[model samples]
Target: MFTIATWNINSIRLRAGLVTRLLTEEAPDILCLQECKSPVDRMPLQLFADMGYRWAVARGQRGYNGVAILSRLPIEDAGDRDHAALGHARHVAARLPGGVVVHNLYVPAGGDTPDRTVNEKFGQKLDFLTDMRDAFRAEPPRRSILVGDLNIAPREDDVWSHRQLLKVVSHTPVEVAHLSDAMQAGDWVDITRQDIPTGPLFSWWSYRNRDWTLSDRGRRLDHIWASRDIAAAGHASRILRPVRGWDQPSDHVPVLASFDLPV
Candidate 1:
């Protein structure tokens, strides 16, 4: 069996210790991290290498958006999406020894203001989704797993309070529709949704909230999607909530999924 995990570490430099802890505890075959916020050269590659994981490939920006995939097994060709218009560090893909390909993504977070007319960031977010849909329609990967911080809560049950967060940035109708279109274009299946068909499931909590536990205003911004061919093999999917209470936790927690496939 192979396990894959995705976590938005917020900043690899700041969270290196936490990452080391996670690598030792979870021991996933492959770990995809987003929001690394450090250049590849500056990232602690040797640390993960010493922990039995090889730094396969990483796409990063200076003190901002960044992504990396660490693997225990050998990785073949890997690359990032050419979202030239937005030019954001949002995507990366790697091919394993087997036919399986893994995609790591960090979708644009539309600002609090949803009006694209006023918010350029919001417009960029929409355009990014559109580009993704077009790209996936052109070439869809087979036997693949796409995982990351999608930044959009696609379903009503994905948020703690859909009624209250309807106007929120992540759950807005426009963002949801665009995300749905992208999923349809890729013909991707939400593996977690397939397993847990009901109730509010969230992977993100607000650091602004004084009492996040009591307020409980969370959104499911992260996801793991699989191609139809390998969707049935997805099992043991879970969110590591306890990690949120760690010494210095990220607002987002890790989401893990295991498949009965060789690494």
Candidate 2:
């Protein structure tokens, strides 16, 4: 029973205590975090180690776009790729003891405008997805799991009001197609959706909403995907929404899954 969790922590240095609480409480064997917003050297690794997460692989930038994987299990740094040539530390991979490669990614949130023509950020987002698809197709993933704040909710049910959000950046048709293409290209299974196949599941809510839970205008922007070969072992998918109510919590909550790795 190997459990892993992913969260868009927003900032690691500021939220180190929150992470510590999660580590001591939920205690997933491994936790992948996104948007660390701290340089690699500055991450609160020692603090996490004190909480029993003694190993980690991370790629980070000064004030934005970073990813890290903290593990109780022994793991090795596998490479970090700067998808879309945006030069952001948005990805990191680690090889677990059983040769299962875990990829932690932070996809770019295309700006408020969905149009690539006017929004360079939006164009970069689309380009990033294309590169991901191409890379996966080039070297198919075997025993792998990819998880992160993908930033796009690819299903109608993934958003609170899909109809209203069709033009919204995260729930737009173009973005959904790109995410689906990437998923199909990698032969990945949506483990979260597979486990809880029917529902309005969400992991992100806007801070704009004063009463986020009451409004419930959320989106399933984060995701956990497993390669088909090891997907059958994936289960126990869940979202830690309550964490959003934590003191100074991130806009995005944690998403978790368990894999029945053979002994």
lDDT of 1: 0.88
- For 1-263, candidate 1 gives per-residue lDDT tens digits of 79999999999989999999999999998999999998889989889998888756788889899999998888875778856367777788999888799999998898989989999888888988898899889998589999999999989989988888888899999999999998999999998888888888889998998777788788889999999889999999898877878888899999999888776
Model 1: lowest-lDDT 10 consecutive positions: 76-85
Pairs with steric clashes in candidate 1: none
TM-scores of the models, in the given order? 0.97, 0.99
lDDT of each: 0.88, 0.95
Strongest candidate by lDDT: 2
TM-score (C-alpha, index-matched) for candidate 1: 0.97
Cα lDDT over the full model 2: 0.95
